[model samples]
Target: MPSFLGSLRQFVLAPKLSAVTFAERGFPGAGSAAAERLEAIPQAVVCGFEWGIAARDLWEVERRLELVEQEQRGFAYEGAAMAFTVRDAMAGGRGTRTRDLLLGPAAPHLLLAYIGIGFAMARLPRPLWRNIMPDLTGTLFYPTMTWLAVDGYGFDLAYFHPEKYIGKQRVPPPYPWEGRPDYFPRAVDQGIGRALWFTGGAEPETVTASVARFPSERRPDLWSGVGLAATFAGGASADGLARVRDAAGEHWPQLGLGAVFAISARVMAGHVPEHSALACEVLAGSSVDDAVAIAGRTGASPADADDTMPLYEQWRNRIRAELGAISGEQRKAS
Candidate 1:
């Protein structure tokens, strides 16, 4: 009976704990993977935290992460951010990291780290948090990351500061590429679209309503962000995915395609957290196998999943060519 109990214990704990290895990647003595792996640390920590909370048996999951929190604290800003994310997740976003750092001094990469905090926020009961955005003084990826925060934390644009958007109607500072007339507003929409996917709990109408507010030309980019959120963290059902896919319209294939790539990249890194896997499974269905084939077709294997972004860009270019058109091109030509 004791042996059987021990086996049952292992079965219950192993999958949840497995993600910890990914979470631990960037700490000291975690080796070369640490340096190359920092970009993925936020995802790892949040996923690990979420899995632990949602585990079959949650008796000691939070307690087990205490040491991880301490270990993550010892690293630099990213490490600190990861530590804070884990601690906040364990504490259900009531954790003090935001009061200590988010509302105060934070490195630029730390802003990226805050995105992880938002991930934890998405998983917590909505009653636990209200208006978590802090005074973000510097101009980094603040616009993009703020949306990430809103989505992960379940906040509305009303909760976002009005002062930040008071400037001229030009694009926001953190344009992913170059200057565009409405680029900033579009990015904001993308962020809001992402938030809507989370804020509406991944409902198709939420994404649709948010996208409708944007100009028709800008909807696809906004939907791209929506697709990402829906697939990466939405926890949508089959009907939900079908609704999302249908709502995506001309963007559906690309959205589903991107979902596959996102999952495949995680798989390449050897960290198939259940949330991401479920996302891919629901979005791509049988196309997931196709995505795996496409990911490998380039004959390039990134040492880390974070390394796959550029490769994905390359793949996107190839896909666009195969589709016989360019994405986001009509506006540029105009």
Candidate 2:
């Protein structure tokens, strides 16, 4: 049974935090405020991550999580994971539970669980993160905290669902009806991009070094991950983005593609992170309006695995086209 505060949190604050229009109305000191909140997220993620590491076993971890939730304060930055981390933290290190929640029929629950893992990652030392993830499926589809990027993207979409989809008051469920199993890798790619944003902190070199720890194939994913983070989290300077792109070598295109997605997502959401607009211009030679136009056409629906893949591809293609167009313009200008 859920605790009283936990139930109230899910039914009340979580929905509000996930609401489409919550962040649209910027507050005074909104930039600083957003940064502060973003910082807190990693703190929560690490706190939960550390607990998982110290636990004797899965049972112990879940028990400690529940105790912590009993005293959890209301929504931190209104992030879905912030309010619901405990629910997902309970499933940490349990392969069966993780699989059932993420890939099984109840996959809507996957977002919370992945975010919980981010929380777990936050607590674990940077070195241990590569080895400690719970292998839900037989394969490691989401290396590091890449899976959470799917949730990060989904949460933003769901938050704006009512406004974007019209008459959709409730945030859309995390799972689409036409679920695409193949989409997992792509989703993980997005998550890795998001992880880059968090892990990079104030330094692009930190991001580069962090990506270096992963296998070479993951380099593209890591570069793109940083791009996504810069788009939403908004701290990368032009010089910094350039350094990252140069460091990417063959993977530069992937990094640019990741930036396109992040920029588009932010535009469609009606909120661009501070400096993200500049980052977009510097990295993509594109404006937020371009992103809004491309992202606006996409819609959300519940679908099965078979149906979701094509849609994701279409979205990818749309962003790629925009990217190609921008590259052409930059070349012509030069």
C-alpha lDDT values of all predictions: 0.44, 0.47
Candidate 2 stretches greater than 4 Å from native: 1-78, 81-179, 297-310
* Residue-level lDDT for 189 in candidate 2: 44
TM-score of 2: 0.50
Residue 285, model 1: Cα distance from true site in angstroms: 5.1
- Give the per-residue lDDT digits (tens) of candidate 1, residues 1-334: 1245434534543234333232242212232332223323333454443433333332233333334432232112333343354455456556665445444333423433454455444344444434344445454434324544432332223113212321111233333321222233444444455544533434566556656665677566556556666654444566767777777777654565546545554444344456556666555543455556654553223332242243324444454243223234533687
Worst 10 residues of 1 by lDDT: 161-170
Error of 2 at 6 (Å): 4.4
Q: Tell me the TM-score of model 1.
A: 0.43
Q: What is the per-residue lDDT of model 2 for residues 1-334, given as tens digits with 9 covering 90 to 100?
A: 4445544544533323222121332212224543454454434433444443333344544454444332121111112232233334444433343333244321323324554444433333434333333455442223322345343443333222323311232222233212344555445444554555543453668667766766676456556666766665565667887787777766665666666666664543345565778777666656777655655554222241243254555555556566666677878999
